[model samples]
Target: MESAIPAHLTVERTRPARKSTSFRPPYPSFSARFDPSVRQVVMAYFGVQHRSATPPPVVSEALAHLASVGGGVNRERAQYVDEAGYHTTVEIRYWTDPAEFSSWLADNDFWTAWPAVPDAGFFLEVVRPTVPRFETLFSNDRLEGVAVAADGLSGEIQEHGYWGGARDRIPLAQNDLLAPIGDVSARTVGDLVTVVPNGNLCLIRSGQEWTETAGDERQMYLTEVEPVLRAGMDFLRDDGLSVGCYANRYLRVLAADGGVTDKSFGLSWWRGLEDLETWSESHPTHVAIFRAALKYLSTMGPAARLRLYHEVTVVEPDQTRFEYVGCHPRTGLLRALG
Candidate 1:
């Protein structure tokens, strides 16, 4: 495919080109385009925790409750085992309008009832990032998480296939470095704990899907690329504080029957956008993952069946609410302050 860089976006031509910067993907890519009138987008995670492989009744109950409310433009379900080996079933939903999200939360009481169920851990993490504070990139046109709430996909975007593409895509990055401000703090009310975020808290949901690959391609991705990806995610989740990352969860997208699927994502919280970019550009773990991915893409060429995508959002303090009920202190964003 011919490269079609958007005229509105510019690159620093004088900078030295790395392999990623020099190589252009054979496949066309796209980004989500939000409506100009829409000011903010909300990404909410409703999760229920369990120790056993089988989810407790409240997990399904929470899922059913979300289904009944049915407010967001997009919703997805995933599960992850935390550092302590606790399993959490999560449903993530996205909304473009803050008013609609507020109404939905009010109607559902934000899963306040889940705490009453004995021994069940629950959490509600909602981030309302203004349109400019977030960015999206997809290897293919298939829409996923937050992107589904977008007005539409762009026509072959240019701000990809490069290291700083994510930051370049974010409008705020044009004028601001998007540094961390203040500090994350938590307040406890009985069994519930609410974490108040600082300014410019960065959140990223980076996903991969290999469902379309078969034979050699599938084997290659599973054996070569995924291991590196998992290692990088594990690094961020386990030893990322030296950098600005607060916490990371490598979550698996679960099937309806509670089986793990071919999909997975790394959900992480960072101090700011600059911190994330620094890690992506300089971290050895990430560099290995990037090289493996580039090799896979170049080798597979057009036939590569793996789909990659990510959505990043930097939320203001006022635009966030992270509440955990009957949950471990390390649950979700709470670990940032804990």
Candidate 2:
């Protein structure tokens, strides 16, 4: 069989050019205070998958419950047939009081009901981070992510350097990186993994937009493009690639009315810049997918209603924090510790 990857798409990888360090922070004092009341955020991923074509009914009901009733749940992004070949949905929820979230988790009925569904597997990761430990950036003014869940933060990080010059701007305790925050945990339906954030982290927030008449273009992505992308992710996760990638998630943006939208965002967690670049440039799977995606976009032409964009931010270890509650044995930051 001929390979799906085109020959033109295969290109040699090269190192990026070094840049001069002439740029400096334009502001002398740039620091934001956190509101005392804003304690933590519960970032949860609820995923389900089955070998059969259709998922169990309980899976749908569980997702609907998360969308409809969960308090402190503010923003949700859903996706289907992810790299793991599972239907996954993530929600960035805020907690004025951590006890409320704990109360909901203590309820065992939902947990018992899900696993009993035949041939189904469900996983959940609830990450709680202190308000002051992480930084965020948004391309649009609309409040989202940490912004929706927390208060007392600066708007848009405008510092220079890969770490966002975060060390200078934000204060850190001596043992923040090595020490675990008591509140964070990760869990599957069966087991809960206790984990902590250990080192530097990077989050890439990227999005795509499509024109109104681009309904067909959207379908093309769902039918043709997304599978290849998901496959590449599976390759990364299962086969392994460059050393530093910790986790990657692709989420479909949901409209205010709880319907899926043309837009989607990807949250990729990395150990450092070099590993991320190595995978992006030299990984055979990524290169092929990149080429195919480009070809598809170009074939659509200027009249096409599709547009894509993304932004990357490197977060310092102290500037970011992660705690996993009831996560599986190896998930997220726990993968490294395990």
Candidate 3:
């Protein structure tokens, strides 16, 4: 099929008409519905890296400090080996309001407590987006990631199962270009480095869970769908700079014992919302992934047990933060600055 997007990018203040108005999901899917009173939400990723087989003392101490200061609506954990060959453990946390997050930080003096140059690697990445700037989609009734903090799941949303659906779900995209402005730059002082992010930076956390699958459904997802997904992720991680992707990390959700589980996600950063949308609609890598997923869902019909979901956001410059302590140059948003 030819791409629905134009070769040249254009900006409009009003929401553009969707090209796939007839599009509908083959199976039921839902989007997160936040409370009307809520104005903004925060998503923070706290990461620690080590060369050892297990987490070091600093990691335990950091976790304890985080527990004592508790303020997030929900939290989840994941692990991955970065390109630099270090074992990275990450804690993803969410908050429904920016004031609540600010109060938590101020009450705890969170900035002063941690060592500026920790013995182990550490980084903090934070994004605070208004309710309208972010969107979510889920393949199952069960909540995951940021959706865990939502008021409820929408009743079978119509904007999904096709390219550009993610853009359609975001309310701000209705009246803004969501175009990126400026560039990411870094400044270092001693062993600490702070990254200044661009305006309208985009972030996505797309996940998969197959724990409930059995029989033919299990084989199909593992053999057909997952391989294609991983390949697309790998391309974004390695060669995607030419396409506006800044960085990518394919992470494995970890169990209590730090063992790998049936869930995993590809966390990525993009230059802007338009860049991400263009790649998803026209890139061959994503095309293969979309086709493979559609085939799996079609073959299994309603009984398909595999679950997929994603949350995408375009954050303003003032609403973003990135800091690193004794970490490699390529860690997290540092790659963008690099």
lDDT of 1: 0.81
- Residue-wise C-alpha lDDT for candidate 3, range 1-338, written one tens digit per residue: 21111112223437764745566555677887776777789998888887666667777788667655667998788988877777788888899888988887677545323564333688888899987788888888888888888877877766666677788777777687789999998878876788878999999999999999988888898899999999999898877677889888899998867688999999999999888988888899999998898899889888888888999999988898888887876777777875
Greater-TM-score candidate between 2 and 3: 3
Q: Global CA lDDT of candidate 2, please?
A: 0.49
Q: Root-mean-square deviation of each candidate, in angstroms?
A: 3.5, 11.4, 4.9
Residue 321 error for model 3, in Å?
Answer: 0.9
Which ranges of candidate 1 are over 4 A from the true structure? 1-27, 116-119, 256-258
Local distance difference test, per candidate?
Answer: 0.81, 0.49, 0.80
lDDT of 2 at 8: 29
After superposing candidate 3, which stretches have Cα over 4 Å from the reference? Answer: 1-13, 20-23, 67-69, 109-113, 116-119
lDDT accuracy of residue 120 in candidate 1: 63
Select the stronger candidate by lDDT from 1 and 2: 1
Residue 281 in candidate 1 has what lDDT?
A: 83
TM-score of 3: 0.90
Number of backbone collisions per candidate: 0, 12, 0
